[model samples]
Target: MKIALIGYGKMGQAIEAIALQRGHEVVLKVSIDNLEDNTIENIRKADVAIEFTGPESAYENILRCIEAGVPVVSGSTGWLDKYEAAKASCTAHNSAMLYASNFSVGVNIFFALNQKLAALMQPHPEYDVKMLEIHHTQKKDAPSGTAITLAEQILEQNKQKTKWVNHDGSNASDLVILSERIDPAPGTHVITYTSAIDDIEIRHTAHNRQGFATGAVLAAEFLQNKKGIFSMSDVLGI
Candidate 1:
């Protein structure tokens, strides 16, 4: 497959290496310095485009790709607040787009485990649920996107908590999501259900960015000739 890389940073470079290893050609690499490379002609030239940019640029980047009549797979986070807008634009333009909070296969499994555990714990009010996520110091978001997804899943099962708290402490009715930024850490997410009797914890630790890169490549491969917005679950068959 011919691929175009949008945002040639660490993740972009990693994805490029894996795509080449898989015998895929990278036709275009658009970085911050070269915004013109993201134009319609450049984006439409590839079979698919993979985006790994910041939250602020994610929505706009996807919009541009859609306008270019190119399918896209984006792993960017924190711009989900505008997900409706992106979805609407994709439908309006009849483009294919896949977005995921964390593209790691392990993380996707953890997401399933999180939902199952939340359902199991919903009937038992004794257990208090909390989430902790740690990432590299350079990560921009406070609580990682994976953490937010887990928190949302838990809330869907347990209606008692309406929102998530991103700090060490929380109010009486809040589900807490703690964020820790440590140097050189790939990614670590732990969800705990605590009770007077015992504690149940589920964690997914990313050894490196390779898993994410590989997943992005897989998404790009799956995105060819596809339409509408999709997710990692669709890519992994989860």
Candidate 2:
């Protein structure tokens, strides 16, 4: 498999290492130092493109990959308002695209568990749910995308949570997603269901970026020879 890496930062480098170990070749690598090389022609050199860029560039990078008729797997966040537009472009071009907030297989499994727990706790209003996410200090987005996804799942199951707040949620209708930035912390997310009696907590803590990189490569492998929008659910069959 030939891979074109659209973002050559830390996460991108991690993905490259995983991809190579899986017997895949990285044909193109685009980074901030060489933005000129991130063209549609260059993107077309590979069978699939893995995008792990910032919010400002993610949409455009995915679109170019779609235009080049290359399957793209995106793990970017904070630019979901334009997600529908990107999907439309992919459909119009008959290309494949996969997007995930956090591509850790453990995180995706945690997502499934979160939804199940939320549903089980729905009828019991005694338990209030709140989340805490810790990431490296260099992470740009507040309340990591994985936290937002978990909050959305909780909101879907529980009627009381109308929205999610990025702090200590005092409002009864808000799901608190407390975000903390610490040095050298790869990632940590905790979902706690609290009540007057007891507390039930589920957590996923990443020691490094290897899990995320591995999952992205797995998504890319699933997307080959496919044409449509996909999620990690399809990759892991969860």
Which candidate leads in TM-score? Answer: 2
15-96, model 1: which lDDT tens digit per residue? 9999999999999999989987788888888999998999989999899999998998998988999999989999999999
Candidates' lDDT values, in order? 0.91, 0.96
Off by over 4 Å in 1: none
- lDDT string for model 2 (43-160, tens) is 9999999999999999999999999999999999999999999999999999999999999999999999999999999999999899999999999999999999999999999988
What's the C-alpha lDDT at position 26 in model 2? Answer: 100
Query: Which candidate wins on lDDT?
Result: 2
Backbone clash tally for model 2?
0
